[model samples]
Target: MNPDATTTGADAIDEAIASGNDFDGSPIPQAKLGLYHQVMGLEAGRQRSGVSNTMRSRIVRIGAKHIPQAELNQMLVDADFAPLKDKEIAFYYSGK
Candidate 1:
């Protein structure tokens, strides 16, 4: 598939872009693309512990830098909110 190439077919390009990219808020930097998995793990840790130790971990950034802008601008919602362990289920919502 040639991303930069233009085709004259309805199926040529997915209209998903019209729906708006949910992950646009965050974009994996070229240098950090390889660390996407590790960054995801860090997000999980933050969600669980409610405390971010990114500065110490050095594995991922704590704020926007930690998240790819494409992801952050889209479906991804960044937050430091903590879940109560006592609660069986917790939900967090983010929107523009």
Candidate 2:
């Protein structure tokens, strides 16, 4: 994938979410968008002590939805990120 296409796919999704429209240009329901913004606003204000930790958090938050657990783990390892912790695995992969 082109690295500069637009940060990451998650970033694009976030932009769409913030715009209150889907990629197809349909309006997102106000209630749903408001709830999304409420939760994400809390996350945005969270304090982080390190860049790597923030990056890992984002990868885990977004990657879990699209990538398989084993694949995501390997991707993280390949990128020099710490492998998923047990709690992360349980939370991100359990339902899938």
Best by TM-score: 2
Superposition error at 82 for model 1 (Å): 17
- The TM-score measured for candidate 1 stands at 0.18
Runs with alpha carbons beyond 4 Å of true place in candidate 1: 1-31, 48-96
lDDT of 2 at 2: 28
Q: How much is the lDDT of residue 74 in candidate 1?
A: 41
**Candidate 2 deviant stretches above 4 angstroms:** 1-46
Supply candidate 2's per-residue lDDT for 11: 76
lDDT of 1: 0.36
Mark the 10 consecutive residues where model 1 has the least summed lDDT: 87-96
Cα RMSD of predicted structure 1: 15.1
Local distance difference test values of all predictions, in order:
0.36, 0.84
